[model samples]
Target: MALDGTGDERFYPGYDYTAPSGRSGGTLEVTETAACSASAPTDLAANATSPTQVDLTWTYDGTNNDYYTIYRGGTQIATNVTTGSYTDSTVAAGTAYSYTVRGHNNTGACDSADSNVANVTTPACTELTPSSISFNGVNTAAGDFSGASMVTPVDLMNLEFRVTEGTGGGAPFSQTDNFDANNFGNWIPSDTNTSNNWLLDANTTPSSNVGPSGDHTGGGYYAYTESSSGSYPETYWLTSNVLDGSTYALNLDFWWNMNTDTDLSCELHVDVSTDGGTNWTNSVWSRTNNPNSGDVWVNQNVDLSAYTSNNLEVRFRTISSSWRCDTALDDIVISGPARATEVERLAWNPDPQEASAILTNGNSYNLYARGTDPECGTVYYVGGTTTPGNSQAFTWSSCTETATLNAPTFSPTTTPITGPVTVTATGTATGIQVSWSEDGGATWSAWFANGATYTPTSCITGNVIFRAQGTGTCGTLTAQSAAAAFDTTDKDVATLTTTNPSPATGVVTIQTAVGVETAPATLTGVSVTIGGSSACNVTGAAMTWNGTTSRWEYSWDTSACGTSAAETTVTIDVTGTDPDCGTVVNAVQLTGVTIDNTCVDGTPSTITIAPGQTVGGTAVDLTTLFSTTGNVGSFTYKINGTTVTSPWDSSAYGTTGPQAVTFEVTGTDPDCGDIVGPVSNSITVNNALGTDAGVAGVASKNKQLDVTAP
Candidate 1:
């Protein structure tokens, strides 16, 4: 308050001193104070709820505070908001948000009125987990060649599966065993034995020369003889190929086995002729079984839809009331619903066949198998460019199968792997197609389609080789995978170095760094132990390796522990053996190692005795006083510290009450520094308590000491 008169004044009584001098006094009254009205930011809820985010929290106590203005749905969005909680990320998922928080007071034009309006409603959209339909199926089949019903190409179906395996001799019916051109005009010339009695002899256990269901292709069947001549209405027919029972549902399926000496006589028939082979009828599927019924293969299925007859001829008969019979037949599957040859999506320009992909030795790949058409079935037949006109449901059945493979069978995880070599391969299939070769195989790398990979950017040394070759559908070159070898040379590993940093006992120089390249990797073994005995003694020639460094010269003998003070801990084992990767051993160990020969006699042990009188000894030669400068060799006689190793008299310590004598003084010279004295002394033997030096009253506590050297 220095108003010109140099006076620091302070006395308030409602306008005086300065107002009275301005001529216009008496009317000079000022009252102005308006800006900090901030105190309205309490509670404003809505902690968290996400679909799009809301989380808005409030609570401010008014320190004249200035920032905070988050409103959503009501518009503002966020102005300053000096920290409380305001997430509101544009809110929108099931909408309904309304947050408000105000606390201005610092020029946003006086605020502090809107503090509670946080009604949130966002969360309501979270449902994701419904995807599955993967069937690339390389070999597809998982169920079809005996692996039952697992069609891939998205639903394929021209569905025809025929297997014969008959021909014990051929010429009874053709197509391997009749049925391809009608082979039964009725045989009976000498009782039928065209090839070897009509086929059906390979004998595969109780009835399967082969062909149970895997759609057979190589095993005998089809033998139907019934002619001991007891002939009860002789009948033998075998026909088929007039089809059209209305197509598509024709199912025939077969696989039977039989042999009858004569019981029920033998009758296995399934007929339906609309008068082409000249009338034949007897459906109800017959089979009699008797005559020891040995062979047992049995697998049948015949609906034929009741034969609406497009002249439908389908028969297989044999009726003989009592005679020597034999009736067999292998896989005959007729299947219906045509239109199914989609093999299973195959594309191989550079698909996945690269892992360990090496191919070239006899490389010749031209695999192409495009077979697609059963988007679902029934389509009657339509060309394909993208469905020209075919929609009974779906059916085109594109067909093409080509395969050829000559080189590809190299597998590698590590065949001397040191350089750039990432090879992989393993008998792959399912419309196969692969190609790879890294040099030894000559050249190839680009026809992949089955989990492939190849890595060869730099390193490849010595016998390095890799090969692979696989072509479609199991044909042409078929599929190969077997040539992988890598040998990156320059191998040797063993590291150990020592020249006596703090060792003792004697000669110890064992070095080994190992880099070996231009021939030199046979160290083969060298050791040096410690605690378990045998600490050095590897003399001349069993170790030296000079390609980079490898040596062993041990001879540390501490004389068994003579001068008392021999600290030890030395170990160094090494073994290198890698001559072109033959024995492959690379080891190195250096353990503990701190061998000091005990000889730096000094410091840390002070107990010069004389602390509480005790001189009634029968024996207590405890002498410890390390102060002669240096070089000490023996002196360790503890009584209460527990190490009594030299002429420890007093009859094994018996002069009772108060005995704590100590002494220590190591240092035999091989750098055995530090260990002067467990210098503590205390002895109160109080001996002399006996009863005649022997028996009687039994209190013979022996002691025999004299005590000197204080």
Candidate 2:
């Protein structure tokens, strides 16, 4: 190639060098191509399809793009999308996000600007209705639903109920200590090493580079172990006050910080005790790794829901093997859900969202409702009710019937009756029916009408027991009366009358009438005795029954019972015996009874009289002048028809040479009547006193005259 003047020069291919200018010559050619362009997507929009998903859509203008790139809050979330719509399945529930879309062309190595920003919020978790529910037979009104709002369709609903036998249920149990007051509120500190126990530190630990620089509550006091105060391998423990977890699920939350030279040289352990801190066998949480260097405070939550005891205790234990490890603790809390004796998860249901439960009579209960959202993986409480004050409880009562039967009454109040017997009784009950039992309630008769009586046909020999039975819906009841006795022995003879045979002679008869006989008791025999003599006694067949007079008769021969002339008193004894009533006796006495026969039948045969006694002078005795041949009892004398003494006195017939005297004799006889004999005699009497001398002269003259007459 060669150049010549000041104007432009051109070089041709395959030419030699020019003489004036030395230059190389090459071929020069020009080629033309089309330009590639892509536009940004427009109208970018995002919609929440569910609690956890978001859908994005936009309009693309150029076809040169191979895919769309998605950005969320300035961060690329997806690429290589061939469609205008994209679904983000990684979004969180109840969260807001800003999205933008861009078009990209991998072949042209270019990208369009981002589309307009799309802001959207994912749907919140689902909630149930009725914040509280309560109902019984009497209170069936609807529940309160003012506290619940649903952001998503509920995937699952459950209604749960639990009966609490305990008396613990009300506000939740909460115990929090922020360590801001420079003292442990309810926390107690213990340690194996007395000098290196847990102590309250304000803002910083005593040793450098091993513990927190400040408390978790910002410059407040915190409990920490002092590593510099004691030997290596020291242990410290901080225990909380007793708590009640028997009725509710509980949680223990606290903030802690640990710094150590080695990763696992120091350790922190959370332990629970149900025996008042005597033992800590349950270690719920533990950490062996240390907080590298910053002494960062980490919040730790330990679930105490597995424990159910009134003496629950929580303690934090730190074991340090070297002085380079130190641990600090602050803002301790012990709390739980509302206190309930029990919590039950009911069966899963999606429709209606209602259920029923049966509660015990004396126990209390609590009702709770929960709903779940599958999209958001959330479970929340929507409704609840409690029975701490007996708001929802049940009591039981029973209904049944009962009847009582009283003892029966007999027609005859007295026992030992002879005729038919009647029984009556009263019962007390609702719709009661009565019956009778005669065999000590072993068997019963048919039901009787109200106020009815039961009577038997014939009397029984032994005692009879009566029972009254009553029946109703509840059951049958029976009552027994005192036993009624019947008489089997003979009846007593009340009265006895006799017809006396006074002045009884030969062939005498005795009659006796006994008292009227009562039924079931009859008289068996009758006996009679006369004059207290066994010879006159008659009994059994000797006495006969007289049907007309209803009397007993006996034949008594008076002649056989020794005769007596004088009237005599006699007693007739009548005895009657019944097979039922044993024996009875009746006696009648008869006075002036003359029983005579032929025993004394003769009279006196002779009588003699003595001559002379003067009147008004010495009396003469004539007691032995009469004689009888048969049993003479006495003699009677009379002179000239005048009754005289035994000896007849002739003094009353003063002038008479022949005075008349009469005598009579009576014979003693039992079989015959009295026998009488009469005799008469004459006696001569001289004139008395002036005749003493004349009697002497007359006696001399009678002798002389007897001599002269011879």
Candidate 3:
């Protein structure tokens, strides 16, 4: 049948159409085209198979349609569905959807009405949960939270953990399975033949000389593949439950004993599956022969850090070529970097998240683990734990909270302090108080206000250490600063004096004394300076301690002061030190110091007399004639270069005519040792006439003759 553009039905040339026999005369009517249209699909049903997929099914009575079309929420999702069932993989997790189906003809020219509506909601994507959580580095003591209320976990590379409260110390994660319960625990054991499966035994395998003498855990159960009841070339597998590896680098450790025949081709394989054991494509470790001899068990470790999956699984496969091969496994342990729950991680923060509320004392806290998928961003809670609680809980106590206080500083940082000092503390805390400790911090003084003065009387000897403590509502905290040293031995003041204040040109003794003579003090050294010159300074060993006088005496050489005609004034300075007192100095001006050492030369260099005189007629006063600038003590006279007294006598010389006379005078000076002067006189001296006339008797006869001639 065909329809024209005018909506009128027409018969083809090769087909015949006839009306029923009851109405031959009336206009013929045909309803064949109206009844030949495709039938509508019925009983449509939609079901969500997974978070991202929805399976749809429907029933169809008529076969006039060539294909089916599916619509989700009034929108066409699939077309040309040849079968009654269709899968819509474009749905979203946790979303509600409405679906309907319709039948269509081969050319899509004729179509049926919409089928019954089907409603469905897709399940949410599974949340990732960690297999283990730890709080290894968290400080659980009171006041450790620093006023924080809520704790949150932090994501570390390949792991998660919480830092120490008020400090960021790292925490580690750990997990283990000893298999002492004689059961597989979370491990799934399977084999090609049921009779040849892996078994958990206490001591050894069924066959003698083919298995471990004992389990790795020492008198505990271990998993092993028994070859006694199975045929050759059989395979056995032991797989672990799903493990979450999204947050941590994981490692597997186990002890195994392979007592297999060296001639047989037996093998043991370790494999990993990322899709919950659907297919294991990664063969991490494999052993073709026995790793050790006898019944000794060898330890094996495998790293699972490369496979980061939420549904990670490990499997152990054993293939035995004969009954001589028996593989034993024990002490399986899984471990990774430390991990913690959100609350546990947050507890480790140094600062508080909220100041208004804090962790309650004596209250138990529950921990739960959760993770986000790096690939799809889906959150998965731990499979076996409740939403707010897990397998671990801890009780909090108020005793663990302590205030944070800093060390105190002293006003005088110099060692050997002798008096009281001020101590100042630095930090932030309520009701802060400070205390001090002496005796190397073994004992402490009473609490005082911040920056308080501390007087130490008992701990005056040796090294003294000072510490401070602060107390508040949270608790008490102590901090020790660098030590302050002190020495309490008594030291006396130094004094200086001189016995001869008005010293002449000679040695002057300067005395130095500390306090009283009997005082218990030691004079370490002494120095004295006079006339403000280095030449007159005396120090060190030059100043000798006089025990008899109970004083330190220094012989100051005044000769270095030089010669002076008049008195000289000078300043004298004395400095000394003692064991107790550091340094002592004294200064004084010394008056009436005379240093006269001047001598005068004679006024005349020489003296001469021209006329000759009789030897005994008169004595020449040569000492009176010669004069000098300095006082003359004595004079000596020489006539003709011969020694004589100052009053010369002519009788001493027989011949006396033009004789040479010299006079010498000596003088004394207070400073300069001595002075000398000389004077010369030329005079003629004749023998006295009566003493030497005529040369005795012969001269008398000649004189008689000469007298007669006169």
Candidate 4:
């Protein structure tokens, strides 16, 4: 179709070829639709403030008129909110929750796409006051508050904590100004209002300026209350007395209550002074607003350990921003660690510090100390054991020093002590000293170094018990030894006497009697010696109990001295002992113990025969040889240097000339086996009638004839 003309602006359909002038015209039309939609919200975030609540927020390009729809786990939980923030309170604790938000128009038809998913999990409940806790003091991870992952690691080391709780011992000074006493004057006021910090009136209604009806100091009559009339800053200073902070870990506790008619500013400031209140520094408990939750009184802990000085003071101040009920304070307590008292025990040995006290068995020991703190007063201690010989150091947890003492042991505990007994004390250590007590430990002897021997006065009479005491090296601590007993009254002292034989010429017999002064006792043994010679044979039996008459006899032959007549002194010595008594020795002497010679001779007379008389006269006799008093026996004779028979023949002396002849005698005795006498005789014979007689020869015939003639 076509057509176009100058003014007509018409077109004709069949004018293809130029059949032109004819044209057709009608109406022409065009149409389109409007687009209205929204984009997705961006940057979704979530926060779980508590176990059961999750707060969500998001960013979006939507207009102010658009609202929001929050979905949890792909399900809508809240809708049509004007703000981008939402709180879901229906969530469970320790559970993960997925959330998303979409911006939408008020018609709910035009809506943006869902925002990014926000995953959040509530944290588990943690206890504020745990039995123990370990904090590394480092935060090592980045995570949201609601994440379930651990943000840091914790380790526990061996640590000791001393939490002292008390009022007096820890602190050198404290004050509780309830106004009952004039102690309120302690709080010197340089400020304007003095009555603002006084005790609360009894039975008064609670106001901003006063305590509640039941509010009072702990276990006291009234509470210290602060009330102001106008907007004037009120300050009260309470400076503690001088305290030695260097020796203590100081702490304070107080009960406080805050109430305000209007929410006006109230404050409590704590400061420490090292120069006795001349200077001040803020303490850990200083607070501008009342830290207490409500009008009820609460306790708070404050530490002042940082100010460790010998001279220290603590100050408390109360100030207010306007005239309102400020704060109520009650029961202020101050404390610190107590100082340990110094003490020590002395060593058991005196000279060496490493020695132990020796104690006796079955005796109680009294432990004494010399060096101790007088502040703690006199310390009395006693310790004992049945077993002795111990280097024992006595220690007390409250004391600062330790010491030990040595014990002593007594010997000769045998019963019925007949003889003098000696007791000795010994110490386990070198320097330990000892003392003794005999009167049942009633009185003690002076201290003896090392050991000592003692014989008590009661040794012979009554039952006696001995005890020993040991002193330590420091001379402070002492230990007592166990008691030893010696008992019995039976004692014996022996005396000896000797008697010589009656006849001293024969065997000498000696007898000794050992007499006991005390009865009911026996002699152990006895020995005897005679004439300074131990060759004597002695025989005796030990005496029995109560048998004091015992004889010790000895027999010795006097002839054993020599086989000759001699005079000698005989002496006897005896020694004896008893179980209960000591040794007894005695000696006896005999002046004339004559050992007579067994052989003696009488004077011999000369014998003469007129002449041989044919050499046949009666035999001449010579038999006056020996004289013996004791131990005499057979005799022997010798003549002319030759042995002769009894009834001797003088013919052998001959009728010839003169013959020489000698005679001797010897005697034998049992005591003196053989003895020779000093008697000897010489004889000469004249042969007058014999051949030589008258002249030579002769023919004269007179001798031969006369030899037979007489």
Candidate 5:
């Protein structure tokens, strides 16, 4: 209600509107601004302890940082570092490895480049096992080296690994015979006689006179010989890893036929030679009724207790035989105070049991090692426990003994993890999803996609593998994560992209938008994060409202990316958000207020002409009947349009009478267009003059279209 006193005088709406008094809006200024202290670390490190193990650890500046991410090579290994350290001990030995670390706040994360690498190689080992030893009339084959390639590496002067992978004895590259051949009498000389040795066919010719020395059949072959002097009958004699004070039993097996046996009876004798084979002592098994039949295979055992030193040898001879005691021995095996290398400890995953205890003194067990190895050891048990086999520990007075332990089985939820998988998720962009499997692809599953990070519930035990898969024409393309392993009771998180950012650039404020349960959600400490990290700018709200739209502006200059302001940004949909949104939030990248001129340029540009107005020579107005209209970039452009000009030009526009001159702001500033559209409206001066001459009273504001009236 206007004041009654104003009735006596002229009253204006704003006549009493002195200076706008009552305050409507004002900013609360704070001189001293408090900020969360620095919390996240810039670097992380992982160390290698064993051949196939890596221990990763990082630093946390306190509640200021959310979580951490670890990477191996270019691939991320784990996110959400609840504890300070992590151990990966399941990968195969002899592989190369590297790692990196990144920290996380609630909103997003800050990542670091990869760390130095940790290289490891498996240890050298020896464990020989041959299921069967066969030697007959024509050809003979011993050990698994039968079908092996003829050519060998130069370093392998004595041997090559029989097999890799399996517990027949042990490791994939386990050594069989110590081809490093250091044992005193390890290398036994063979007979040089190729023919007439009876062990050779009658058609075969002898290469040289029979003697004990160095000789061999190339191209994977075997030959035989006889002792003419009846000295050390065969080439190799038991070398002592023992002492001279020890007594022992000698065992031997030979192949011969009574028909081939010389008319002279070949006698079996036990010879003892100590002090380097110079002096000799011999014993005889002269019984005529002996298992003498050559056709049938016979095993002979003799006691050498009467020998003085452990350096004793055995021999066979027919002194006065006409056929020179023709003897043919295929294989001669000796078992005495011998130490066997076998499975010391066995188990896939032993429960709280000491590994040392599992490998006891001397208890042999059959080993059924499948999947390519030398030969299965004595059968212990097949297809049973993860760690099978009996305690076959080596009791060397010196060297270490170990039993084979089968690797624990893995149960992953995913297989060959794919990338860019289109999954129907709650809030995520269309991209690829990665998955993985452990234990020989036993189980397969996906990681929980949390913004820029993913975490698997349980840990991985043995083989851990991940694949990046994506949608393609054929199906899905999955790229494998670097091959690595772990042991039982191991847990892992995928840190494909995990890290925390702190001390933002523009009005920097780190915060968590979602639930802050995991200390290590994807990116952390961002103003508004899709995923939540433990550390946030949490003053009972999302970080800072830092955007070009807000009055309190922030600077996010893209001049210096990467190291300057690069952070993990996980994009998400916002049904409950504002339409004037910008790019996905970067952790705490923005620093101070940078020039962000988002203040809409609402300068009036829509100058208009009223109806029954004329400009130039064109008639344009409502009374003139101009029905058709068109849009143009700028009214000036429309007015000045010439050859090859749009139909909106004044020359082609207005349909009749007085043409009006005007401008519009259809595509101009949004706010200004709504208010000042068709501005500067006016009628033609000639038409106005004509109407004035015919009028009686002063022209009103509407009639005097060119006049500005209150």
Candidate 6:
């Protein structure tokens, strides 16, 4: 009210119109929250297929950051379901419920706005055919069969059954109350260790135990008897699909409290069908876990590996027990593609310098030579399943002037073995082809090859010689690498190549081969020495290769040999050594040395019959030749000219012959060094007197064990 430059604290009623300017201010009130929405379907699912359950898919997203505040008409149903769909499987059939969704983020405070209401009704079990199926023990007097015929699955697809037993007048199998739960079918058949033991009883109608259809149906009903006096079979099976190379389990309810069968092993077998319903095979490998209570629902799983396979029909061989038991079956599931290891790229070129790949894992695998190896084009050779998982990698070795995947070959040194033995062949190469025969290539094998990893599938085991061939059409078809023996008892022999200038810590390369012998010929006394002393360290060193002499010597004790072979029988001990390797002052940095023999002197025990010897042949008297009178331990011998490791304890030592005899002790001892002369000796022997005439004629032609390369 006041006005004009008059500074006063008093309120002038008359000068109120002369007010001054002021700043902006307003009310920021929070608005009232929206009401919670109604509930929606919580668990939504879709089973529009044969399953009799309701597949309900509902949503409750009326509001965000909230639960699916669901309601079933009169009452609140599901709450706090954040997913987009909900399946109400427990709904009643033919009856629909109006559903509305409201968001409630666990706050218990649902939205007030209800979702657009929709009604849904549950579906009824469509295939309502009540089924009854069971056994009618065997009949002896009729010499045939009697009792209720089997219930064949005319409706195999979309089929379900409930056991209804009685004096035969039956209703819908499931509705028959006298047959459920506590009760079971009568005259059950038990599987014996038999071919045909469980059959129908003698006194019933449907005299032919099988169904009118005339197929083999196990134990009929009502008129069957129990007989455990003979060795027979009773294991029954109802055809079903469980084999597809898929992981699956047999879900059944079994009750076998009174089991008396000893040769019984209850199993769920799945005979597989791979070819679109043409041929069928068994797919059951190892038996799964045992069946639960023989009468109660028990779930069992079995690896479907050992079963034969076909296209569609997979017979489920249920109980393997000979004792009368009961098992109810349900929901069998098949799942899993779990890959432990898979070779996605298996490409290789004959030329190591070119693009190539090798397998290092020592497991089994089949190398498929693809004409189009993504990068290598269609290769000619492919490998088969490799085993042991450790041979996953291979080397592109060099032979002569060309690169190869082969090991060093050798003629039997020290004691000469049979002639024309294969020393080495390509280890890992493209299109590896190999075959062997003692008949001078008169005939060859189902020769095979690997893609790139030149690991052999079939090994030359016996006296038969082997020759490997690798073809690289892009390059050329290389001749057989080396002739090796197969089906032999010879110890495998091989050489180890090291890194050129090694890691200064000694060289490292996989020892791919061992000399051919029946027993594994271990590389004993193998030591890596520097400066001409036994050492384990060779970390850093330099050496010069004399073009002519090809010899190397270390100047000083570069590094201590940390790597040593003193640990195992197979592993080679490499000394770790490091020092200024052959500098201007020291000269040579690294050198190669041959290890001394560490084979424990074999023992010569009492003479037993030898494998090959005639009654009149020179019996190389074991007592005279191998008597522990000298150096002897537990000894192992070799078949004349094979690399098969024969068991040490022979029931009989054959008569002496132009044959080799070598042996070794069980354990090593400092007191006992490598066996002297293998306690080994050789003598020629003739055939035994009382031999099979056919064997006498074709004894030399006895087939040898086939070699399978890995």
lDDT (Cα, tens digit) per residue for candidate 6, span 243-292: 33322121222111211122134444445555643665664422322222
Ranked by TM-score, the better of candidates 2 and 4 is 2
Q: What is the C-alpha lDDT of each candidate?
A: 0.43, 0.56, 0.57, 0.47, 0.32, 0.31
Tens digits of per-residue lDDT, candidate 3, 112-209, equal: 77776676877877535323222322223344433212212222112221222221113333566667987888788999988778887887677876
**Could you estimate the TM-score for every candidate?**
0.22, 0.31, 0.29, 0.25, 0.24, 0.15
Candidate 5 residue-wise lDDT at 144? 18
Q: Which parts of model 4 are misplaced by more than 4 Å?
A: 1-182, 185-190, 194-210, 214-219, 223-225, 290-292, 339-710
RMSD of each: 44.8, 40.5, 27.5, 39.9, 44.5, 41.7
lDDT of 2 by residue, 515-609 (tens): 65552124555667666432343434346777775667888876655443433555666766644446454535443444544343444223323
Q: Which of the predicted structures, 3 or 6, would earn the higher TM-score when compared with the native?
A: 3
| Candidate 5, superposed: residue stretches over 4 Å from native | 1-185, 190-271, 278-509, 513-612, 615-638, 642-710
Model 2, backbone clash pairs (residues 3+ apart or across chains), number = 11
For model 4, state the Cα shift of residue 282 in Å.
2.8
Which of candidates 4 and 5 is the stronger one according to lDDT? 4
For model 3, the run of ten residues with the poorest summed lDDT: 701-710
Best by TM-score: 2
In candidate 6, which residue ranges exceed 4 Å CA deviation?
1-338, 347-391, 395-461, 464-710
Residue 334, model 2: lDDT of: 82
Write one digit per residue (lDDT tens) for candidate 4, span 1-710.
Answer: 43344444443433542223664454433222222355456677889888767899876555633778887654478987777688897665565566777777654467676676676877665433212121111111111111001111111122211111112222234445554442443344334565555444444433433344444433344444455563367665555667777776677766555545434457666778898777777654554442222344444557776667889877777676654545556556676554323122222222222212332222222222111112211111111111111111222112222344334455565654434455554543245555655554445677665445655553245433333333333233334444444444435555666665644555754566656655323555665544532233334433222233445555566655534545445454566664453544454544444454344434222222221222221244434222334444465666666666544455556455655456554545444344435344444433545433221111221221111100
lDDT of 5 by residue, 1-710 (tens): 33333223333433442223443343323243334332444345545565446677665554655666665432356877756677775443343344445555554344333333232233322325322211111111111112112111111122211211223422211112221222213224323233223233221123232211121211221223333443432332222232332433333322222212323344434354665466756543321212223222222434443445666554443222322333333233443332233333333321222323343333323222211222211221222212222221122111121211111122342533221222212212224454445443335565433222323323234444443433333232223333344442212221211122232333332222322212223323233222221122222123333334321122323223223223333221111111112113322323322222223343433233334434322232222212112221232222322222222223333344444444322223333232333333333323323222211122234532221111
- Residues 599-691, candidate 1, lDDT per residue (tens digit)? 433433322334333333333344422233334445555556567654345443334443434333333222344444444534444345541
Clashes of each: 50, 11, 18, 28, 78, 192
